[model samples]
Target chain A: MWRDAALVAGKDLRVEGRAKVAVNQVAPYALVVLLLFGFAFDQDRPLLVQAAPGLFWMAVLFSGLLAVQRSFSIESADGAIDALRLSRLEPAGIFIGKVVAVAAQLVVLEALLAFGVVVLFQSRLGGAGLLVASTLVSTAGVAAAGVAYGALCVGLRARETLLPLLLSPVLAPVVLAATEAWRAALGLSRGDGWRWLGILACFAAIYLAGGAIGFGALIEET
Target chain B: MSSSSSLTRALGISALAAVAVNAWWGLSLSPPDKVQGQLVRILYVHPAVATMCYAGFGLCALGSICWLWPRTRSPRWDRLAVAGAEVGAVFCAATLITGSIWGKAAWGVWWTWDARLTLTAILFALSLGYLALRRAVDNPHSRALMSSAVALLMALTVVLDHYATAWFATLHQHTTLFKPSPSIHGWQLVTMCWSFVALGLVFAWMVVHRYRLEALEERYESEGYLVAIEARRAEGQPVSAAARPETGRVLVGSAASAERAEALVEDK
Candidate 1:
């Protein structure tokens, strides 16, 4: 299962590497969202600084949607999904691989957005341990849930519009926990950042296990 | 004949009677609270309706599980799942509106980030998404499979969301009615219990009717396919071209008789 996962993840990364859509489009879009948040705050430096953690994750969530859509769309075109089904690889492996690939893209996007938040919002970064831990755990949770939902909507007519409507509510907890954790890490609030990180880890674990177990049934539908 | 069965008729009548009696008792007989006064009246309907909302989703999750299981999979379970979700969505909306009203009266705001309110809002969105997915998929089996997966996912998220929000600061009251020592006694408690019965009956009635409606829809859809196939066969066109992949199983040997096709369509 692990070998199959590696193979699928490698294939997805290679396709993404050649396409360069994440690097070229999604990453820039994430930064653009950050800039827009700065504008919405009316260039109030302190307000933007305090709001940076939330704005950063909001940008990640939105861009993460695109990455997920891209991941599944690659399969929908040319009946690639059908081919994957016929390949006899385990569905759980495919699910994890997709999660890994989407998380990889999100981590890079988060790095860029982190830089954008600091430079644009004029905020200082602290609590690096909490910051990095929350980022990875939150990304994993979001990716697992996103890939699972993407698989559900793939090959359907209204998938493009339907995916966000279905996915955003589920990811609300991740956004909430991640924002709180980042707020604490960035010293914007006086709460335990580690507690929020624990909650994020729980969210990630639940979705990861649920997604793997349920992915076979989901993709089998198409 | 109407779609309702005797069971539904009985349930509907009981629900109406219970609700009427509960309303009179709650609004008139039940004395005002020492703390909340008239504002406590919202309590009778709000908690009962909210309970039904969760019950409906619980039923939806149960039906989805039955459908997802290989041995128990059936269109009946899928219909139950959709019915539960549709009814649950209605109750969920009611829960939010009534909760908002209670918030305004008690908290001096139309809404707040209270844990219970946030959880219900998320659950409402989840149910809406489930219904939307149902509408998007054209194939019944695929719709069942996809929506069932989503239903289970929603169930999981609701549990996690409950805890996640509970850990946050909350303005909503904790369980007052269900606690060890009851907060209220006499008429308030009686009215509240009756409200549950009334709303529970209403929920059952709606779900039964909704389930029947879904069954009729499936029949209508299959019958429509047959009529189309029959039309194509009469026109010397290949009937296979008109047959949908999902309805293909019903087409074999069943579409052979024109009289049966005409009768089915006419019955609708």
Candidate 2:
């Protein structure tokens, strides 16, 4: 099962590795998103610093959403996804693989987006100690959510729209807490950023478990 | 037919009655919140809508379990479940919109990223997306089952949104009417309870009516599909416009190509 999962994950990463498509899509968006934020806040350094958590988190969250919507787009062409499904590999494996790939895409996006935030908004470069970890944690939650909800929406008519819809609401607590934690890390208060991080981790775990347990039932439909 | 028809009528009348009572008590009987004043009136609608949304999601999930596992399946009950969700979406939207209106009146702002309100917005939006997806697919079976599954997922919103208010603490006020927050007496309690019951009845009525409409539409669509399938089958193609036929020419032709090398292992 683990090997099967690795193969699926490897297949996705290999495609992105060769093509640079998701990276290509994610990088520019992350950059412009920061630019847009700068435009929105009108370069108010004080407000930007104080509101950094919300702004950064929202930027990362939206970029992840865009990536997620298109995450399965590659896999869905003609009989490719179905063939992958029919390979006698476990559905859970396929879900894990896709989620991991999505998470990798999100991580790269976060790095580039973070760089843009620091350069454009001049967000405190000193406080990125937990930034990568936080990004990965939140991305895990988002990707697991994307996988679970993505499957449910996959056979639907408007999957592109539905994936984000079903996931983001459930995504609130993590995004909120992560944003809060990121805020605290950015000199907001000494309140437990770790608590929010823990919560985000829990959210990610629940979503991952949901995908694994639920994927089997989903395949029955397929 | 008599039993169901009268039930529908009773439901209809009761729903109307509920609406009338709530409006009366809201507009006239119950006094406004001491601090909130006339703006307090938004309570009657907001809480009612929230409850219906929860109920819609709860019932949809319960119905989904039934729909998923055939042993528990009752088409009538499943349809009723879907109806609950559809009706619930309306109420959820009402909750968000009225809450926004109330927030503006009470807080000097129309909307905020406050946990509860944000979550309510998400729930509303997700259900809207689910509904849109349903329309796009136009497959009756997929719509019924998947929509209910999507609705079931909305239960998570109540948890995520309410978590902060319940645990971490927040500015969103918890309602005292339904929850065990202290106690109130006299006309306030009576009016509030009366409004809740009234609205609850209205919600039930709406759900049943919605279910009936779904059944009607499902019937019409199935008949239409059957007619189409009959035409197609008569036209000599084991017709399937979303119905997967096991072995048909289009698939067979595709299979019959040089890919026939693999055919001995698989039957088409």
Candidate 3:
């Protein structure tokens, strides 16, 4: 399963590497969001620094939406989905592969967005260890959930519009947990970021298990 | 013509009678509350409807579980899940509106992010999403399977959301949890119990009707497909049997499907 997942993830990354959509389009979109946040706050450095954690995660989430949609949209074109089904790969492998691919894209996007926050919002990034751990775990959780829901709505007429409505509310916990963790990591307060990281781990576990088990039925319907 | 129809009819009549009686006692005979005065009257609709909404969602999750289990899988279970979700959506809406009404009287606001209220709102949104998902999928089996899966997820999320919100609210200390009943005695308690019975009966009745509506919709969609097929033949258009649309409802449109659908209705 891990081998197949790696193959699938490698294939996705190679395709993405060729197109560079995440770098050219999504990362810049995240920067644009940061700029907009700065404008919305009227360039008040203190307020922007204080709200940086939430604004950063919010940008990642919105950008993550585009990444997940693009990840599945690649499958829908040129009978790629049918090809994947006929490739004899396990549904679990396919699920894990998609999660890995989306998470990889999101991690890079987060790195860029982190830079944007530090430079644009003048926020201090103090806890490097906690920041990295929270980023990886929360990205996995978001990716697992995003791909699961992305698959759920794939091939439907309303896939584009319906994804947000269905995915966002379900992802409320992830946003809350990640934002709070980032808050603690940014030295905003003395609150424990580990607890929020633990919550993110739980979210990742639930969604990853659900995707692996439920992917067969979801793909079969397509 | 089954015995259950008579039972349903009896239940329906009794539920109506109970509602009428409860309304009279709850609004007229019951003394005003010491704190909120007559504003507590919204309590009758709020708690009963909210309780029924919870029961409806609980039924939906149970039906989904039954449908998903290979040993217990049946179209009947899928139908029950749909029926419960639709009814639950209605009651959930009522819960929000009545709760909002009560909140306005007590807190001078139309809405607040109290823990229970927030959870209720999320449940409402999840149910809407579930129903929307059902409508998006054209195939009957796929719709049933996918919606059941989503319903199960919603059920789990509701549990998680409940606890999360409770803890989050305690941490913030900005809002008090909305609990309607502190201490009730005498007629208020009796009337509240009667309201529960009446609303419970109403919920059962709505589920029965909604289940039949779903079955009828399946049959209708299948018949429409058959009509299109016949029209294509009449127009001398090439109609390949292998190329037929995979509606999965053709069987349900035929006599066996009708019998099975009726059986489910009667069995309920």
Best by lDDT: 1
Give model 1's TM-score versus the native structure: 0.91
lDDT-superior candidate, 1 or 2: 1
- lDDT measured at residue A10 in model 3 versus the true structure, 0 to 100: 96
Query: What DockQ would you assign to candidate 3?
Result: 0.57
Candidate 2 ranges with C-alpha deviation above 4 Å: A127-129, A219-222, B1-4, B31-36, B138-141, B160-164, B179-182, B231-268
* Candidate 1, superposed: residue stretches over 4 Å from native: B157-169, B237-268
Give model 3's docking category.
medium
Chain A TM-scores in order: 0.99, 0.92, 0.98
Q: What does candidate 1's lDDT look like per residue over A53-96, in tens digits? A: 88898999999999999999999999999999999999999999
Docking tier of model 2: it is: acceptable
Which candidate has the highest DockQ of all?
1
lDDT of 2 by residue, B72-177 (tens): 7667766766776788788888888888898888788988867677777877777776666567667556666666666666766656655657764666887566
Between candidates 1 and 2, the one scoring higher on TM-score is 1
What lDDT does candidate 1 reach at residue B56? 83
Q: What's the candidate order when arranged by decreasing DockQ? A: 1, 3, 2
- Worst 10 contiguous positions by lDDT, candidate 2 chain B: B254-263
